[model samples]
Target: MGHQTETHVWDEELAPEPRGRTWRPEAGCPVEVALAAVSGRWTTLLLRELMGGPRGFTELRTLFPDLSAKVLSERLRTLRERGLVAVERRRGFPVRTRYELTRAGEALRVLLVELYATGEELLRLTTASETRDERSPGRLEA
Candidate 1:
């Protein structure tokens, strides 16, 4: 059996939902929720790599040469557990598995593109400001 990450019900003694079961947030921070979905250091980059297409382990390893096999495996497992990726068993002389993005993962592509663009613009602005400050010593106010 697969491990279940969520609790079905809360302890009634402490706090109870009128419906007995609920999926809505209870005054929790939104950023906390978002971060929970994409918390690992390599998760964002992994997602970006997957956005291109389904890739084999070797392909991913080549794409991110700095990541160790152990770290890559863990990240892949995490993504699979979160339902962002699906693994298919290949049928042939040598059985193997392939990973592909789920529909949920595909949905993140546009948002990721926008985020990348925004980061580029911010970098450009910051670099320009730093250059100007260096060029004119007293022009920038700290």
Candidate 2:
């Protein structure tokens, strides 16, 4: 199917999806910013956990048993640097630290939801493709 590209914004037809000011997605691009926010392994999961509410360091470790404390700390640090996560320290017998998403970070809820839906669609398409390939004439599997 084909579609028209005449719809205008800023008095110009906007660049197609995946294109920024340049061919490559440069700094300050929305795509780049979003990717940077969710770049590292376990980053998205950490965000998801924080999305529920603020969580202490120990709670995060317990929630993700497979994730090492070192890696978990690093991910949280990165999120903080990106302004997607906020950290609060409570003075007590043992100083407690809790992590929560900032206002900008909370906006990622929509993005995560969309990513999940889009991933499901992509997986479905991939599975369908594999089935078609298996039934293709003259196809061989090793």
Candidate 3:
């Protein structure tokens, strides 16, 4: 993935996504950001499953026990619209469909892995801090 070096132009007139906020790059081009759209509850789970390889809708449903078929369909449609996934028909006696990540989506896998690692480290630190806090005595009010 090529990083934007110079300041790419931004349109102040453009409307934000569902939420009323725009993403301004810290030091790069104002390319359309992908985080907000795919950073929700079941989004990462969906992406993680796709990382193993393309799978059919039924297969996806099986992986996420709690997710309803309706919700899965919605998420997949959203991902497709965002260019994060490609949906194609599978040729068979009975026609079926499958979903797979796009190049940009695959790149996001690396970022997700890094985020997972960071989350684990934070949890460990939090647990340690809690243990220390529990053992330490607090001051009494005068």
Candidate 4:
């Protein structure tokens, strides 16, 4: 005797009403939405690079040599899905594609600049603290 598996069918009458677009952050939480859009490794760096203007895939890959092509492609797709980046393809002897930041993406430039500034400040503070610790009488340099 052969074992039989049962398949379940979804019935509209039994199904719950679709909750439309629940992933969107509530209107009051703009920061949440912004963070959600850029929440991934190298996402900010990709945005920062795009701020300079449109760049080919090869150009972007060269900028971050350590990043694998797969991750970069994924990041670009995510940015596109979020409406932050637009891709343009030029047909020629050698097909060329370039990505440019949309207005929304350009708007993130200021935020990125502020973040860089904050990072610099944090680095300064950390280095100063390390120097102080090294000079303190009770501490031994590692």
Candidate 5:
């Protein structure tokens, strides 16, 4: 019988395909790769912004005032290395540089949208539960 999960049923056992025994986060792991691509503060926001169109460093920094310039640069560099973002340097008086999502990055659009929806649902449920608990005196506080 397959291993049972909330959202999936493994045909045999839930294990890494290539790593037969130990599953660890490394370049060879696809799950790790996906998580690494999107794991960082302001990363999803950057990708979301790029979804609309290409943007320059100053433009992104201006849009997100709270995000520091150093952090922004680091995130962009990581994204570029991950092959999720393409950097275009337009030689001019000021040397304009633009950042846009690559094909792989664009593929994450659905994932981001779904993540937002899931988060909203979780928040809604939590709020409703909290409101009920506050109003109900019979509710036990544990």
Candidate 6:
């Protein structure tokens, strides 16, 4: 043997395995699924309002003064599709429709409360920092 050279071919079996905890959101993950369901804009607000009781289209619109009717309608539709909201159409001369939170939606009450508390704490910290900066002798206000 005059000269010998070794060559290696990488294969699936020879590939390095992933280390540490894998963090992928599978379809069966409840937390991931819940987040996906509530990730839409105005979703959390709508859920909070619905948690109180059933609300009609006009009533919901009134709660969100700046939101347009079209957007509200879309949000409601999305919630209904996610099984978080149930819409009941009352047959009357005026034909009123009411939207209420389903059991699944109601379960998010605790999470929402925690979120509100977290927001309050964050706001408090931000205000405190701003006040401290303003009072600093060498700091310039922008």
lDDT of each: 0.78, 0.88, 0.78, 0.85, 0.86, 0.84
TM-score of 5: 0.78
Which pairs of residues have clashing backbones in candidate 2?
none
TM-score quality measure for candidate 4: 0.70
Task: Please list the Cα RMSD from the true structure of every candidate, rounded to 1 decimal place.
Answer: 11.4, 6.4, 9.7, 12.9, 5.5, 9.4
Error of 4 at 125 (Å): 1.3
**Candidate number with the higher TM-score (4 or 5):** 5
Alpha-carbon error at 138 in model 5, in Å? Answer: 4.3
List, residue by residue over 1-142, the lDDT tens digit for candidate 1.
Answer: 9998975667775345444344565334443444455669788898888888898877889989999999998999999998888888788967666789999888777767877899999999999988977898567465
Per-candidate TM equals: 0.68, 0.83, 0.72, 0.70, 0.78, 0.71
Best by TM-score: 2
Off by over 4 Å in 5: 1-30
Candidate that scores best on lDDT = 2
**Which 10-residue window of candidate 2 scores lowest in summed lDDT?**
10-19
Superposed Cα deviation of residue 128, candidate 1 (Å): 1.3
Model 2 quality (TM-score): 0.83
Candidate 5 per-residue lDDT, tens place, 36-73, comes to 77899999999999999899999999999999999999
lDDT accuracy of residue 88 in candidate 5: 95
Clashes of each: 0, 0, 0, 0, 0, 0
Candidate 1 colliding pairs, count: 0
lDDT of 4 by residue, 29-58 (tens): 555566776789999999989999999999
lDDT tens per residue, model 6, 8-125: 5435353333321125766655656667777888989999899999999989999999989999999999999988899999999799999999898898888889888999999999
